[model samples]
Target: MPAQVLAPAPAVTPPRAGRGYWRRLLPALAVLACLTRVPSFTRPLWNPDEGYLAVQARILAHGGQLYETVVDRKPPLVPWLYEAAFAVTGSGSLTSVRVLAVLAQLLTAALLAALARRRWGDRAGRTAGVLYLLVSVGLNPEDAQAAGFEVFILPGTAAAMWCADRRRWTAAGVAVGCAVLAKQTGGAVLLPVLWLCVTSGAARTAAPRLAAGAALPVLGAALLTDPAGFLFWTVTGSTAYAAFSGSPLHALTRALGNAGLLAAACAGLLAAVARAPRAASADLWLWLAASAGAVLTGFHFFGHYYLQLLPPLALLATAALHTEPWARHRTAVLVSACACAVFLTWGLTAPRAELTHAQRVAEAAARRTGPRDPVLIWGMHPETYWLARRAPASRYLTAGLLTNYSGGRDGARVGERYAVDGAWPVFRREMTARAPALIVDDSRGKPYAPAHVPTLRRLLTDRYRVVGTVDGAVLYARVS
Candidate 1:
């Protein structure tokens, strides 16, 4: 009797949608992305490193000069973006450029979400987007303050992946090229794309695909941006930085960590690719590209430089976070938080070395300098530029990368090339000819005085006399 009654009780319906399904989830996540990434609308000077970018952008926007104006090696896309931003907003302050980062990052988050749809379906996609929004929020404080293209790592990766997910080679190539334009390090992203094509080419159903579509845009960007700049990147940015890393394990360790974390994160992506239906794994080609970037850029790799690989990595992390039990994600987030705090503090503080030196020189020189009076700098650090910001009074003297700092190996290198390229000509033709009243050379350094370097001292010969000196630098004048 009880069984008969139960049978008659009618069937209960199953609960189908979770409270935050993918469709409902994305908008909310987008809002959250905007909130975290868009705060502090208008504050902070451009970080010194960023100043070069801003200056170059102004030069390009006005068509002044490309490689000549900005001696730094990278291509011209970031500066161009900054110029266009200035055009529309009519604001050239560091703040205006920062807003562009927000937009780039937002688009990046959206890209990650689209990528997720390919990997884990809707839920994973939305969650990955949310995580991207979170990552953008926690960028180094100084990073938050600047308006440069470094933050595009995530969005750019996402864009490439988005195109790959749809089998859109031309669009994918354009996205990859755009990413490279944003940062030279972004060229590594193509590995993922090629991997997909090659893997697919093996299948009977999959036809031979055009790899040139992706490679061509990046090649075109290199040509348009600066053929010389690309060559310089190979010579200076890549090779020199690699050589620099040889002196310090710091660069090597950070690179290993970035690669290891990326690889661990990518294992899940590879798994997802394996589990995916045919043509499904092409979407993961973005991860391959990002990993390639991590490997190549490990040489001069600053944390901010690693930003390009982060979005795809985070999406892969989302897959990990989603699959793993509670303990791991909790551990990962906490570790990431602590690391971020340390990183943010360092980013905000590290520039002080150059900034303070510049401030001191500027203040001191401002007191003594006249517009027409020539000023000469003898030390080897590039501190004069920063100091010059405050004290534009004296003309900077010295050649082939002179420092405002009193001592360094760079100063040594100039001496090594003295007879061939030295300040002797500058002294006779520029400073002595004009008879400047003051020459400042920052003499102080961690190890010792740069003024003591024989070449610098030797170079400051009979034509210019030592008038005065300071804690770190010194002042010289053409003998009057």
Candidate 2:
């Protein structure tokens, strides 16, 4: 017989090359997300934002109304999300909320991967997922790792973009609405979603569906909360809160500095995108612009605000990297790694004494009061309420409302000039109605010291006596 000639075996592609591979790899990616944030699990509080949300959530879980009984300027969903997490993991478990934040981070990575895979290829998808997992927590671990509003909003905003890419108009709108419920800046996602619709000439068909879908969550939230209070805190009052009362020169310098730092941290990814044959798509450009607007909204330029920029940037960067040569790809990777190392090292090693001090004050306050006894913190450390597991004596979690000290500006110069006249009466009524059993003054003098306010000074002098001082916080117990 003639030598049998076997045809060259067809190129065998590994299972990972298949379309279903990304879906199968999702679980592993989710695990990566959790692993990256493990440090968050050890700390009870990473930021004051978490402390405020935790305290408000506890109040909500205990049948207190949102804006009425417990006050915060954020939208209602985050507190409710925290309440749900508490229900599952037991009340006051900061660890559980951190877990919830990890889950959100995982979902966002998955969505970004799926979107990239649909648009480019499997490699791009995997790169996007891994890049997001690394960079999201790389900027400032203290803020990024916390179960803050920024962490929670990413999943919703990313989902909206994924749905929009698929032309699922109604679902995309619903996702945007949910994102807004997490934070007002989240609504910035809607601009890109609408841009997609208009660019595709589907505005007529998609716009109405998008509107209807977006209304579901907003209307639902309104029904569940005090409508007037919800509007005031989330919308009306936010006007004043968002205003830039600080010096224009200072604002400009800070904006440039923060923006530069963020750009430097993502230098590799930005370079890859710039070098790609096909630059970012119009919708993505709009998405980046919208997210940038969101970050600059309050002119505060906080570290975590930069998080809103990551999803779109990750997608753009990974998609661009897919077509780059190996040498260039290696260079991009090296730059990004160095940047991440610097930021992560600084964030992880930064002193946590302030948090430790807050914990000590809470412990001191707890020793002097019962679990149900209401306690008031004269300073801005709402974490004390959550740590001590005591109800707040007043709805004002921080003295910002009373002192008119905007977190966005120099608290000293802007003090009292912008103080809400209406808040003082409400504070007096609530404090008089149910006096706190303990008062923890963590003000450390100057801005929010009770001595600065005659009313607060008299109340402290007449009703309470200093029992102890821990760190810088003074604990006063009610005289029997």
Candidate 3:
């Protein structure tokens, strides 16, 4: 340095984010997670899926067996999860299940953040978590906030990805298995995880461990539950469910509509990814593809089904954010911010309406029957059981099986088809074993109406008399 002009002081570098940074950031993420779910907190029912799970859980809590005593096409863990929630917070509390959904989201966010941080850095981690919190609810709040299979499977799915990224092959497998146990589509995570292992050069060691770990939960489930029932409902029945689709043109139209909806809701994230310098890694693309396949499995692109796409999208979007300057992505950022604002506002202002048609029927049914009485609902409203505080008279919660009316299709064509080959016998046997005290014919004019099915019409005529109607649902009382 010259005598009068010393070299400029070395430029001071900002300290790399440390434990203190995460210590503060984690709690902030938790707060954001809770805030986003505020809308689901007040509503007693957000979606029919919740009611289905709630009723199943209620039955399970009251000593009913999964698949055998309480039936649904879903895997066993979600019902068990509901049972656990009911156990802690008391049965028939939608708020409790909603609370658990919040916790699941929070946990998923934290896991994604940690996974991104481990792979990328602190900025990417923070962005990933924040993005998940905002975008996870960017769709219809009714589906997004429910304790549905998608919501419950997320934490496990995220954990599986995180573990696979870290080369924790066995843990990744177990997490994926747990996710599958929540929803059959969760097995889609396995492809990305296997790809991760292959790319990481641990395919041999990791593959066996992953397979073994995955089999643990599934085999345990088979042993713990009714093996035949579990297999039929989850595997065989789900396959049939997924296979049901309309004509090719109609299916394509539906698929396109679903894609458009997804694009609109995820515009910010999509834009951010477009602006990125490089495409996401192959494993991530595979993750996205697998999730898309899962969403399309039933050919019913429900808003909630799009939720499986979020973790991958968030990670990719945050990766883009990490590489690009924030100022350059102002439009995407603003779009995302606005999306979050709109979602939160809707949640806060959504009408806490009076009892739904199902609930009104539930109420009327409840008034007519004792606590121990079993009630039957004729349509797709299994939530009536939970609302009525009554046990279901049959294992078939909804009439889909009885009518061959695929839940994935429009109800107009329901009666055009006959009942599934073996469904009516099971229905008759279950009804005979434990006669329902009240039958709510929610599908009076719909295709699945009892009047359209001779057996159902005869049974209702012989054993039940129309007593009342609530909100268009005809209520029938058992004639002693």
Candidate 4:
């Protein structure tokens, strides 16, 4: 018989308490995130939707209904969220909104850190949190200037990521509900939810969780803000205009644009997943869902739609870096540093709303005029008129469609095409009736609202004589 020597019991090192560390760490990270995200918040509120959403929030806080006052046909989640922020902050100023978006980004980063720790352990999560802070430029409420929809989608999707990974159907459903209520693009989670519904362990557990989770929106609607006009916006407001995502064939064009590198990356991920079936389920879900969102947004939606993918892509990128660092076992730190740098650069340089000197000059002109002044802004943010503490000149507003929102045929088409093709005829009519006294149209973002995205129709330029030029914006006065 081989003598088996009894091995001495291994000594276990006592775990250190994290209370002190967490106490010191959280506020520092939060301050860092706030500093980066709040600088140019005014940029996002400048977007049309932000103005709409902000108005709705103010209305909601005053216990007002949406359809009665605002063009709020969508779900009331965003307004209510804004209301809560407003209540706590006691201000309806856009500054409060920017603060909320920054806070949301911070919380989102914290949640991502939690998810990362569960998947990759403590170190990676902390690293991800720091990275999130450093690169959270667009995650702030100021993002409303660019597109608040993406920020709205992040929290719920991140929650969904957490719940799905834990195989908690109800939790995922709740997250999905909040997301959907926040923004329409959140419906993108349908694919992953379906995947969860089909799996075995998920079969029994997922349904009830889903039902419970669904109650959030219903509850929000009943107990909170009731946006009865939501359906109207979904059916009418959303499609009233043609999408500007690089045109109809944009999907094919963008796909082909990055065909070589994208294909290789997807192929690589697919193979790796196939080989590692036992890998962390949360990580896999994050990667696949994000990849799906990227492909869907890139191929299906307009370039602006890329805003939807920021959070997930952030997580996916973090996870990929974490995994690769382990495999390569060398230069992991260097690679992470480089990735952080890239993210920071992207955050800082992402396409955002900005007012040029010309815009400022037009603003000055608008200021020179009073609310009683016939301030015609055919091609600019009408709010500039309102904000300068002035009012607009006419009832016919230049927006997505040329439909008669008030009444009468107005001899203009209603579909989204009105801006792209219908604008010339409509502008001619508006010029005939009430040419704007002032105009401020961008060379980017909503500038293309009337002119279409990617390129503006120079033909529309013929209707207006340039009163002033600001940055990429051209302020127009009706050519007599």
Candidate 5:
């Protein structure tokens, strides 16, 4: 046969790589949205911390100050986030708060999936996303329902890891700084970040970039607002938090209670080390260790605290799962099945009683007080203040913030310092100055009761009378 000239195969264009990434990410995001979004709406704001955050954000949005008008033992970033959310969607809407929270979690999952895929492979990445969604939504009932600090910082941590893996040192540093702004514990991300910069052949160039990036957000926070207040709350105020929350032993007990999570975390780290030495290096393991320390330092050991561990654990677990001899397809199938099963378990066990009661209380509070009025709540339900659209009668939105619990169970020496005898008169003075339209006694004879704020107790008895009751909380209207 005569040799024939054949036209070169038409230059084939590889479909843009980004399109493939989105194609995979969109479906996963849809699944995560289904797992988190709608369910958040059905749940009520029962967490005191969530309430504190929502109300504080509203205060900041309304031209008031953080740490001055509203005090919390957390960094300013979280409230700033809530402030932005409230600004976009009216401050009065709890749905807005829930939406903000769900969006944060979903973003974390996306970043986590991207990082996993980048470090390992496509299948590993997909597994990481599913695992994160499952564990996040399946957080223990006591701490899972309302958005917490962990949720806000998770995406930032994941983004830092992803950027570091790509050798984008400055961006990764910025991510770490943002995470710290969300919660002081996020500072732990720096260890692994430094590890990456040091290990990367170009340590001199990378380290300085990383440090420069990290300083921008923090410096901005200091220059733009109350540096003194920020220092006090994030640094000084937080010094006493762990002591007041509980002991290290209590945190250990909580960790033991969630043995499955711990097992998975260990498995992933060990598996990656065995199968993918370069991928799971000492620096990465150090990141995991640092993350664990961050979680334990709080000592409170709330279920939400473990959310901080999800990124490293998910990465390790996915790598570990990949090491199995089973076919990749089979391994993926197993991961999907487990995620679905745990998700179902969470669905079945979730309670509705709190939801129903919260609705009733919110409705009652809204009816009794105007949006501009001040409301005094004796116990620690800041959600009611958010729902009522009322300013707190005092900066001590929760009595615990101003009450001395030194001799009590979760005792700490600093309680006397912060909640000094001087605090009671201030609390009484503020309540009198505010002249709240409605006083909510949430105690129902709990330990944080009339005795906790005797002055407020007397004021409530002398100037207000019981008007109605909802979910064990008594509402007292000022006698006109």
Candidate 6:
């Protein structure tokens, strides 16, 4: 028989990567690029959402339980992050908090680039990183600016996705666990990450490892620190959040409108996924569904909620922009770029609610009150309390609890009680016992009203005197 010779096995070519120098420098450049927001980092806290977290962080730093001393309908992870920041650089320094925030954003951007590069190509990786930085920093409104919980969630989610793609199942689980700790919705990433492990034939081993890795931070924090606090805030307390925020349909409309370029790119991404190889497409589609579920879970789709979708969406968009024919890629890029440009322009130029006014208000309050003096803000400006480093007089930091207790129009609709009306007596008792040294009423241009809670009305009338006014804030000093 003629000697049978096997043809030389086809040589495999490693995918082309950035040139040596570019590879070394790109990630560094991405980090530096994200840090450009350093200028805005030291600005005073203005938005209530950030202020709420900041205040809770301050509380934690001062030996307060996550839910007992301060209350919110979210998880404890963000408060812990803020507490850590306070420990590192002294509590209530806008610069300290913002610096930590910048670092988080930078880390997230770098991880996003790594994920894009590994899944797509070097060019897509760089593009995705740059895109995320711009969209996150530039496109976010003032309310969602610098250290938002959503920003914090990004790095963890991106890390999870990146590790899962590389089959680092345990690390992926840990990363996602961190994300979930940051925000309750972070658990959403768990589905896709475990799915990847199972489909890749590592389910038996990877699943347990992933579960253990994920449970470490959460379980450790819960058991060692505050189990009841975590359970109430993250799960039970959050039940009423959706009812008061907005309907799912309304949230969907607002999310699409605010998401801007990202929404459009997602449409293109769907098309790209449809045309992709079956295995890869399956992963991408599952990821998208998982992200969408996370965003929609509370049925109050805040713009930041859509952020969790960015990594998968960015990957798919990059594929549509670069992996396809020139004509289609060009059209996709142009449409996305144009929409992104419009959103970016608006975000950059849209007049932001100035914190200077808020800072001035907080400074005035700080000057009037002593270190241990309890300060009360009647409205939603928790930032004032955080900036002044003054402890809140009552467990209910903002009036949302008080106003929503009786089924106010602003909350769970007319006649549908949002909070237990039974809590009103407790609210009255807490405020009366605390007897806040100074009350800063922020009605957001409306006259402060204590009508909602009769106890507040009595306290305002009998126990407090209007000491001064700082812009829209009416400062009341305890008199009786």
The most accurate candidate by lDDT is: 2
List, residue by residue over 1-110, the lDDT tens digit for candidate 6: 11111111121224553466256646665555544454445455536678888888778777787667677767677777788877888774657666666777677777
What TM-score goes with each of the models? 0.66, 0.90, 0.91, 0.63, 0.82, 0.82
lDDT of 1 by residue, 1-480 (tens): 222221111112122543345458656765665565444343334344465555455445556555443444455567677777767775345566666776777777777766665555555556567655555434444444355557654566577667655556667677777767666666667667545544434323222233555556657766765676565643453333333323245556666765554344333243433333323333343564555556455355543555665665566566556556666555555555454444444444545555556556656765666644434444433334333432222222223232221111233322323322232343345433455466565545422244444544554675567666655677766565
Model 5, range 2-29, lDDT digits (tens) per residue?
A: 1111111121223366468758775877
* CA error at residue 164 for candidate 1, angstroms: 1.4
User: Candidate 5's error at 152, in angstroms?
Assistant: 1.7
Top candidate on TM-score is 3
- The alpha-carbon lDDT assigned to residue 374 of candidate 3 equals 86
Which stretch of 10 consecutive residues in model 4 shows the poorest summed lDDT?
1-10
RMSD (CA, angstroms), candidate 3? 6.9
Residue-level lDDT of model 3, residues 30-67, one tens digit each, is 89888888888766788778888888887787788887
lDDT of 5: 0.68
Per-residue CA lDDT of candidate 4, range 324-427, in tens? Answer: 64553223334434544443444455554443442364466565455455554444353444345433343323344333221111223333344432334544
Q: Which stretches of candidate 2 lie over 4 Å from their true place?
A: 1-19, 247-261, 276-280, 341-348, 411-417
In candidate 3, stretches whose alpha carbon ends up further than 4 angstroms from where it belongs are: 1-18, 247-261, 276-280, 329-331, 351-355, 407-421
Worst 10 residues of 5 by lDDT: 2-11
Candidate 6 residue 166 Cα shift, in angstroms, is 2.5
Q: What's the C-alpha lDDT at position 289 in model 2?
A: 89
Q: What are the lDDT scores of the predictions, listed in order?
A: 0.51, 0.79, 0.78, 0.50, 0.68, 0.66
From the highest TM-score down, the ranking of the candidates is 3, 2, 5, 6, 1, 4
How does candidate 6 score on lDDT?
0.66
The C-alpha stretches of model 6 lying farther than 4 A from their native spots are 1-25, 28-32, 35-39, 244-253, 261-279, 325-350, 354-357, 405-417, 420-426, 444-449, 468-470
Over the stretch 1-480, how does candidate 2's per-residue lDDT look in tens digits?
Answer: 111111111223355576468557787788778766877876778888889999988888889998799877888989998898888987757888887888899999999987777666677677888777767765556766788999989999999988887779999999999999999999999998887776556689899999988888988898899888888888887665687776566777766766777787778788766654432465777788899999888787777788899998887787678777767667766777677667666666767886888888888888989988999998877888888888999998987767755544564444444555467778889878999999888888646677667667888899899998888788888898
